[model samples]
Every structure is written in structure tokens, then in C-alpha cells.
Target chain A: MTDLLRVVDPGLYTTVQDLGRPHAISSGVPPGGAMDRFAHSAANLLVGNDIGAATLECTLIGPRLVAEAPCLVAVTGADCELLINARPAPMWSGIFLSTGDELHFGARRSGARMHIAVSGGVAADRWLGSLSTNVIAGRGGMHGRPLMSGDVIAAVAERSGPGVSGRELDPHLRPDYSNHTLGVIAGPHMKRLDADGRAALLGSTFHVSRDADRMGYRLDGATLRAAGDELLSFGLVAGALQVPGGGQPILLMADHQTAGGYPVVAVVVSASMAIAAQLVPGDEVRFEETTIEAALRVRRERRAALDSLRS
Target chain B: MPPPRSTTRVRIHPLGDTALLAELGTRLDTALNTRAIALAAALKKRRDVRQAVAGYATVTVHFDPDQTTHEALGSAIKRLATKRPPMEEPGRLHRIPVVYDGPDLESVAGALGLQPQAVAEIHTRPIYRVFLVGFVPGWAYLGPLPEELAMPRRDVPRTLVPAGSVAIAGRQTGIYPLATPGGWHLIGRTSVKLFLPDSDPPSLFRAGDRVKFFGVRP
Candidate 1:
């Protein structure tokens, strides 16, 4: 058996994603792809699929799969309930399936987005060197929309002969989505804010508002007053918590626009981004301020962990 | 939170592996933004940096993880922080001809307490520098309009301000690169394509470009 499964149950929101498009920002196009890049990559590697393969960006609920041939698959990122023909399938583990077997993912137990990678990847047309879906522009990834109840996606053609079986990622590599604390690095405007503004930013507890999406996550918390009035328009990136006129902080995410004019309080660090991706609306988030040194150290440790798995 | 400062200081932070996020400073102006962009570019040139990403008042530096740790990269950046150079003078001048006949022209002139011709004269009197490109692709946020000509933005933004529309907000003027929703007061229109996505230099104006306007004949 060379290929994999077809979608029998397309849950809440599932879209295909790869690394994302980078060069399109200057044209008012956002670089959108997988929210959890590390998790996506790990899942792909587990199934022996190429790192850039089109994987499923499953939201609160994941899709159901029916195998058409024997194939290996793995799930990474947030903990979600999984079942095989009504029997439970464990999260964060690799499994094999034969033709006619069924796999279904239930409501999320923790986290927002999950990654499901099959051995040969999802067969979809590539645009701008990625299969990531961009719903705003209505392009790429399964006709630029979320998966529905009855979608049948064909498996991609295999490049390497089917000689390897899927393996599970090291248990330690799994992210703890239940944790609300995230690390951040001080930004250029840190000097602009006064001591109290800075203190309040780090000490406060912010709830992820229901308005959160791939574009950005709006927070409901102690109003964060800007040090100055309006600001000049500048570039924006993911993890930026921009406070506009209302003083509410909005954290930009993977599908964020290339530029913005809101004053940011702090930026989420790289290592904690996977955790950020798992945040759902109403999830509580508290920022644990760290020096640039701490943020970087965290990143290095995470990378080292990932490297060890690959080796 | 402390008593709000009269002038807001926008926060800037490094977003790992991707880009920088510059929290917008208070009263988005041309001068501070110019300093921010140039400083970001300069700060990026120092040791072990990969890319210099600037926005508003914050700049993020992206580097290769294999070459260095994020800690080393951040400390290296903090050491390099310093005052930015004066806004770099524009390399070249672009004289764009604009037809002073937008729908909002009359209201804008009245708000500035000047006749339509006087407003036009004030607009064309001084050459402006292109501070930065943002809001939409190729949109040029041009600057330092004569204080007398400076006007508040329209309470209701146009749903679709045509491409090439010359508009003004408090202390600044700009050319819309494409047809998009805008809140600036429109005074005229131009035919120059400020942004061409397919072109080599997608943006017509860089951070350090100069611009002058002329009254075009229909």
C-alpha cells in the first residue's frame, strides 16, 4: 500500500498548510501557513513525508479519515480526542492503518490547532511554493476554504519508495497547551513606556477574546494605555500585541498583515509560539516578562530538543 | 498603569525567526518613523544579524539559529541600540502631476480656511520626503504638509479611495497605491502607479525618496 486516507468527517475547521509564503508581504499579502510550524514539521517527519508537505491545520475539532491503503500517520500539537471506528486513538502518537479503517477526531481537550500528517502528504496544487490556505484572498489549499463534512482529498504521489514505517515523536517534544504563561522579549518601544505601564504589562492576566482567529488574537485585560498618542504606520509581525486607541492589546498571529500602526506592549518569544497557536477563544493568557537573554535561551533549548529527535 | 504620557512610546520587539514588531508610537508622525526605520536598518548591520525588520517604532532582528543562540543575538542587538541618523535625504525627486478635483476637495479647502487655489498652492509649495511605505502595498506616506494646510481626517473613510488619489491627514499627505478603504481627506488624483506588485521594486517610494507635486492639466 502506497497511499493513505480520505476525509470522512471534516470537523470544525481544517485547512492545508506548509511553511507559508514570505515574499508577498510588500504587496499587501500576508504570509499565512501553519500556525504551529514546529508541530507541523514534526508530524510530517514522523510519517516520512517531506517537511514542506501539505498537512492538515485542524482547529478545535479534527477530521475523520478512512484509509484507502496502508499508510502511516501522526498527530501533533494540542491534545484532542481521537477515535478509530468508535475506538479511542491516543493523541501525540503515530499509528498505522489498513484500507477500510476509520479515524475520527473529537472535540479538543486542550489547545486550538492540531497537525495531522500522512506518509505521502496531502495531494493539493501548489501556489507560490506552498499549499497553505489563505482564506482572505480566497486562494490555495482546498479551494481556499475550510474542510466540510464530506471532503475527499487524494494522497500525494510518493517521491521515495515506501520503505520506512512511521514513528512517534519523543514524548518530551509534545507541548503543554494547558499552560497559560508565555515568555516574551522586550521590543524597541520598551523604553517608551513608563515603569508602571511596563509593570502592568508583565503582571496582568489577559483573556483571549472570542474574536481570535488566524489573523490576530484580541485580549481582554487591564486597559494598556499607550505612552504616546497615535503612531506612524510601521511593519507588523506575528506575536505583536498592538494596543490601539481603545487600549486593548491585540496579538497579531500567523496570518497577520505585513504592517500596522498600533503600539505593541511586548512580543511573544519564538519558543512559546507553539503554545500561542493552541490558544482558543476565552483561553486565559498571562505574559511572563523575560529579558532578551531568557527568550533566546528558551529558543535554543527548544531547537536542541527538536534536533535530538531528528538525529 | 501610570498616568498616560502626552506622547506615547511604541514598544518594539524581536519576533523569533520571522520579523520584527514595532509598536506604534503616539501620534504617528514622519520624523519618529524615519528615525525608527533607519535605526532598524543600521542596528541590523551589526554582528550576526540576518534580517532587519522594522515597523512603526519597533525593530525585530532575525538571525540563523544554527549560527548563534537567540540570547547572543538579542544581547548583540541591545548593545547596538543608539540614536538614529537624521532622516536620510531622498536620492531623487519625483514630480507627480495631480488633478485637483476630488470629491472632497471643496470640504477640505473650507476646513483649512482657504480657497481651493490657496490650498493647492500650499500643497505644491514645498517638496516632501517619502517617510515609509505601508497600509497597503506601495502606499507612500509622504510628509510634513504646511501647518496651515494640515487638516483632520474625515470622520467617515471612503469605502474605496481610487488608486492614485492624493489625500492628506494631520501633518502628512500620501498617494494611495491601490483602490482601498481610506479615511484621509482627498484633495486631488494622480495617474502615477505608486505600487506595482509585479515590478522589481514593488514600491514607487522607499524610506528615503523625495516627492513634489504639480497641478496637472486635464
Candidate 2:
């Protein structure tokens, strides 16, 4: 038995996400995992938990969790107003909570999603080798769906233990979702675009369209269509910048389909996936082309930076 | 003599630090799928490579960058392509009892110049091989749809396709395990639970499985 965190209000939309079902995608299962892997890992690392530990992936607004057992908790990603018992609490660091403490998440001050990592990670059922919630399929996570009001999420078997507290991370490493400049590596199908088509994609700024979900970020910007090329449905990677028939581009995200027919112009670099995930509808985004080598180096640096944070 | 017919070659690309894609062929081919399965089998042996997601003509290998680098993973993929794995024995035949009374039964029969019974007979004749399982869970993309019964996807997809709805589109046929918006023509339904989330194996059919759909009145 463990402390049960009863959900008082399951905010705008919340789901449990981790590294996700990477293996399951081949089986036609969408890689339904955390939209922003970097932040998800960081939150767990902050509280001395495994990086892939299942955490509450709070989208926009967050849930009101009433802790039934004393434990340590940390919140990262989109900067939301986090409070414990109506009093403001610090995010990005573990906050020690007593049994029966109510954790309130207010309006989002920054970013579009937030991750709440409880100490020892949350106890959940794993489906097809992952604990990540696939809401579309209604499998995995706590009871295979989003947290509902009065739902009690099981904490680890041993909830009351030595806890890490008040340890904040470096501010420089934290991303500001306000300025969205995503780095990309030009194409699996870059040459398919004509000169103007290329310019339209690279030159103009695109706003994150409302037709956005975990599947992809549909961008509204300069019409960047294919140059009379018939596209065959093939394997797609996360962050693929695809130009569908509509002329507008869609950036495939963490939960993208296994394959698509649209021609890919570019893909957001691995280092900028966190930035891509933070974009809310109406957020302006400028796409910057970078070499694959440079993208790899950036990711290496990001990992090293994160490594230094480990005690 | 003209150059001997060329065999399709596999191409590898770095998707990210954590993954790489091995594009086996430009077009969709069963050979590509075979190669993907072989690559997946080979990569599974590698401690560094975590998973291999085989798609149309490509298999994306997700790896732990900390354990392996892009260059090393690429080399492994290249090495596997040089020496491919032989295809496993064809999957066992599965009898799927389906009711041949779908909303589109008449329309599909009219389009194919066949009676509704003939359509059902054709659908159940050959043991359809499972090319892949995607779009939704428990939804196996079983096909070659027998040339005669094949038709393009409906222009206007239904808003809600009920679970167990057996549908066909293009050259593929599958059952919708859950209610979802789809463009595939619904011909009938089945009673067997194709997907049970809480059970082990979760998915009833794996890639390469063979299925035989039979008409069941009731």
C-alpha cells in the first residue's frame, strides 16, 4: 500500500508520459509519449528518480493533487504557477510535502506543457512494454486514460522516505518558450521543393496553427508545397517537416503516425524538440536550417550540460 | 545484353542522435518488409539498439545515444543489409468469422460487378497475410485485397466507424478494433475480440500472420 494522490480537478488535459512506446510504433502504435522528452527527464532527475520514470504530463492547465502520503515532488517544463495548499511553491526543484497536503497548479505563466515528477516515480500499469499513456488507444498509464476527478494515483510502494528538497537547476539551461526558433536539418526529401517552395519554408515565419495536437504541429505560414512530386508513404521520424497537399507544412511530433505520404522538407533537430513541444497555437516560429553534424553536436552538448547537473 | 535487373538497395540515414532510418526500397515492396524484419532481428541482438520500428520500406532503429553513436548504429545497419535474414515460416492461418452485411456491401458489390455473396467469398478465399499493424491498435493491415474486391478509399469517410468493423481500402483490409473516423469501406463485422488491452501479447495478430475471413450469419 502507498499514498494515494487523489485528483481534485484534472486540469485542462493531463496524461502520464515517459520516453513513450518507441518499440510499439512499429506495431502501428503511435509513439505516444512525452511531447518534450528533455523536460520530462529533467523533472525526474531533479528528484533523484530515474529519467524515464512515469510523470504527470500536464498540458496547459494542471491538476490539483492532494497527497495522501508524505513524499517529494518536482515540476518542470512550461512554467506554471505551482502552489502547495494555496501558497506558492518552487518548480524545477523537489518540494517536501506532508500527508494530506494539497498541490494546486494555477494558470500557466510560461510554456504550453508541464511535467510533475513525484519522488520514486508514480506506480502505474505498463502496456506493451511502456507506462506512457496512449489516450487515443485508451491503454497504459493509470487505468489507461487521463486522470479524472477523485481518481487516486498510486505513489510508489514506499512513499515516505528520505526526500531531496529545494535543489533548483541552472537557469541558463531552462528554455523560454516565448522565442520559438527551432533548428532543423534539411530533408529526407529536401530537393523535392522548388526554389520558391524552399524560400517559403525557410524564409517566412510560421505560426503554430490551432490544428495542432500530440500527432503534429500544423503550421500556418507561407504556402510551401511539393514541386510536382508524387510522394509515397514511407517511414516518418519525429520532428519531420512535411508539406501535405494543402501547401501548409506539418511538423510531426512525438505522437506522429508511423508513416506518411507527404514530402518532408526538413526535420527539427533533436536538440530543439523541447522548443517545438512548447509552441501553443498562435506562437510564432522561425525555422533555422542547420547541418546534421551541427545538430548532433548540439544534442551532445545538451546531454553533457544535463550530465553536469547530476550530483 | 541490357544490364541485369537491379536489386533494391537499402539506404541508411541518421534520424537523430537516438535513432537512424534504413530505407530499404524507394517503393513499397514485400522484399523491403523482409529486409526490415531481418534488420530488426539483427538489431535486437545489439545491446545498444533498443527498438526497430519497421515501416513501408524503412525500419527506424531507436537507440540509446549514450550506449551507441549514430555512426556505430549506421555501420551495424549497413552490415545487416549486406547479409540478410531468411524469412521465417509463414504465420499460421487464422479463421476470422465476419458477418457480410456492412453498410457498403451493396455499393462495393455494384462497383466490383459482383454479387454481395461473391464479395464475401473472395474476401475469405485466400489466407491474407498481415503486412503490418498500424493506424490503430489490433488493426492489422492484412492484404493483397484480391484484385477483384479492391477499390479506392471512400471520398467521404464516416465520422464514426464502430469497433470490430471489417473494412477495406486500396489493397489493404483490416478490422477497426475501436470506433474511429476512417475512410475504409465497411463491409461487415466480427465477434472475436481482436484486441484485449489487459492480456499478455495485447495484439492478437503480429506482423506476418495470415488470416482467413469467413462469413458468419447472425
Candidate 3:
């Protein structure tokens, strides 16, 4: 082990996440990567780390860690209070930590998940080429489980370039959970729904149910009756809005099952998936339909925006 | 080589900006699944493609939007699907030892009007093909359970089925590697660990692997 950070309070739910092992879906593995890739990338960029660097995805509440070595750290996504040694520390910015420094997070003011990117990233156990923790499968990340108090996480601190600190991302690039609308691609199985049923899917608003998690988000409103008997289990991508027999919609998230049998009404475009991920329970969400062409364009623009921040 | 085209063309659809779903066919045919797996294998080699998910009749490809466009990925998949796929390589055979004592064994025996030992004999004989693993990791969906052993999923699903519990549903048989809620009828138990997330290949079975169970003294 290069170095290890002792967990003081793992908080609500903290796990290691990188870009995720997308190809492992063939082996029935869910793509259990960072739910909010936008924030995750931003946090990594703040620390001068690349997109592939493993960052800790703090769910709702964040973890308290004691630094065992000198390194750079940055927190992004949910606008949470960051404190070091009982003093206020900046968020969405890189901060250099000395040995024995204690970092604490408090009160999520925005978004549901936060990303804490450390210099050189977490070298936690990698499974199928990803450091993301898949709790359902009990594999990957730190010991294949949620970070518990007293658990030690390994971080590889060697870097190619000199570590930079005291830098912040432009405010415009920071994620704001205020935008409740998610863009979606029409459907792979939208024909499963009748006209009014499709209308209910896009027309009605959905309140995030408590059932929402990395697997999927269960929405509280809008019923879209699916036509026909049960479908054969088919491949599902992240961001699919599947409406089961109950008529209520369940939006698949990052850690969604590789396959599902439900009828899909629409797919949330990748450009807006991070926006969808940041939604907390009880939050209202609306869907805006976009063409695949437009969705691709939006994604390119977003990626370009993130790339520009690194320069 | 002639342009890739099949009598039944595969439909390429969008999952989003980052992924594309290739619908090989509408029905549940083994040939369709083979094509999906082949297409996935071809797609996975592309630098622009991130991941390819093989389902019963569909292959969902998660790509890097930054490196590739939706149109570009769709075209690549179309080209790949149009070509004749190479024959599938034979899968490795796995022997799983099982204890036939189960809560539903007697009920299943009664339902089939057969002895519990006969049921175990049938369950233990066949070399089941590993269909695409899903529902949970390392939980292989073994198929076509001899028709005689096949039964519909329970009307009421159990809230928590224990790990390594062997089970069956209509036209399918499997073992739960990890405890979770399930609707399949449990018939036995296995001692093998099917998944280790920390390992290089986390899952023990892939799509086409062969599996056979043997009765073990309990």
C-alpha cells in the first residue's frame, strides 16, 4: 500500500468510484461508477488529476478523513460545508493537506452526492478494470463495501506533475441542482406505451421517491401503462426510464442492472444524467425530450466545457 | 468481404449520448443472443466504445461521447452487425456440488408427481448453458431446465433468499451467489463462491459457459 487514510466517520454512504467498468456489463456486472460524473470530473480536475482517477462518492453526507501523507484534495458536486482542523476550507477548489490533517464535511446544501478527489486518486481494489464500488455484488472499491468507521483506504500518491493547490473551478462549471429538468431520448420501447401513456411519461412531473438509489430512482408521480404482456429480459443502459406494471416510472441510474424486462418509455440523455443523479428524495423532476442528434451535441459541448476548465 | 447483412437485420437505437442499444431481434431466440454477443465482442474492441452489455436479444453499447458520436457509434455497430460473425468458442464446463434438501423440493416433487430423488437426479444431470447473467452478480441464468423441472416463478416472491441458494423458474435454473429478494423456487444449495469483486474476473460464469451439478452428501 502506498499510503492509507483512516476513516473517522464514513458518513451516510461513501464509496470509491471512477469512470466505471462499462464493458463488464457483458459479464452481468452493473456499471457501478460515479453517479455524478460531471462533479467527479470537476473534482479530479481541481486536483490536477485525470478523469480516470478514482474519487470517493459521498452520498448525501460526506466522510471525515485523517491524512496520513501530504497530498492535494478537492470536493465537488453537492455544496457541502468543508472544514479542516476545525477551520473552514473551500470546496470545488484544490487544497493541499499536510500529514495528520483532519477533513470533515457537513450539511448538504445542494445535490445528493459529493465527489472528493484526492491527488493520485484512490488505488482501492479494482474489479473488472474499475475502482467503483458495487454494493449489490459485494465487490470493488474499499473491501467491496461501504466505508465503515475505522476502515483504512489506500491512495497511490505518486504523480507525474507537481501537485497544484489553492485553485477553484469557474462557478459556471460547478453543478447547480436548481435545474430540475432532465433531457431524454425518445425511446427504444416507447411503442410499448399508447399515446396518452406516452403523454403521461413526458407531460407529468415526478417527485423523487425515497426508493431512489444508485440502482434506480423510483418516481412518485405519472403513470404510464405499458401495453402487452411481460417483455423478455433485454439489455438496459443507464438513464433508461422504465415503467413497470405498477405504471410508476423508475429511472435507471449508474449502478443499474445490466438487463431488465420492464418497458422503457424514454432514456435520459447522457448530457443530463448528472443533473438527474444530483436529485435528492422529495425533489421534483420534469423531462424534456430531445433527439439523439441534439443529445450528442449537448454532450460534446459539456465535455468541451470540462476540458476547457483544465487548461 | 461482402457488406455485413443478415436476413433479419439488427436495429440500432440510441440509449443516450453515451450508449447505443442494438436490437438483434424481438423474440427470445438463441441465435439472436449469439449475434448480440458477437456484436458486443466486436464493439468492445473499438477505442470509442466503452462497454457492451449482452442481453437475451439486445446488446447495449456504452461509448465515450467525448471520443465518438452517436451517429458514428451507430454506424460502427451497423457495420459490425451486417458482417457474418465468427462461430462461438466452446465454453468451459463447471461442476457444482449441491445438497438436494430444499424447502420446495417436496412441493416441487408433488407438483410434478415425482419422487424427490427423481427430481434431484434430473436437476443434477444436464449440462445447462449459462445464459446472460443478470438480476445479481455471479447469479447465472441456466436454461431450458429439461421442461419437466421447469416451473413458473412464485406468485409471491421471498423478501430475502440466502446466498448460494439453488433455484429455478420457468424454462430457467440458477443459484443465488448472494442473498437478495427473489421469486424463483428454491430447490437446493451450493457451496461455491460465484463472485469475488476484488478478483480479476469477478464473475465465475460468462454468457456461454456450461454448468452441471452433482449431488453431495450433507
Model 1 per-residue lDDT tens digits across residues B18-102 = 3444443545555555666676667566555554545444454555655665556555544444433555665578999999887
lDDT tens string, model 3, A97-119? Answer: 89899998866787898889887
Cα displacement (angstroms), candidate 1, residue A53, comes to: 3.3
Leading candidate by DockQ: 3
Greater-lDDT candidate between 1 and 2? 2
What local distance difference test score does each model get?
0.72, 0.79, 0.82
Best lDDT goes to which candidate?
Answer: 3
TM-score of each: 0.77, 0.91, 0.91
Ranking by DockQ: 3, 2, 1
How close to the true structure is residue A262 of candidate 2, measured as C-alpha lDDT? 78
- Cα shift from native, residue B58, model 3 (Å): 1.9
Candidate 2 has which clashing residue pairs, if any? A28-B134
The segments of candidate 2 whose C-alpha lies over 4 angstroms from its true place after superposition are A157-162, A227-233, B1-8, B67-71
- lDDT by residue for model 1 (A195-278), tens: 777787788889999989998888998877777656666666678777776778888888886676666667887778888998
Docking class of 3: medium
lDDT of 3 by residue, B1-218 (tens): 99554434768777766777788776656667777778887888888877776777778787877788777777777787877768878789999999998778998889989999999999987888776777566767787588899787888889999998989888778898788898888889989988766555578988878899999988
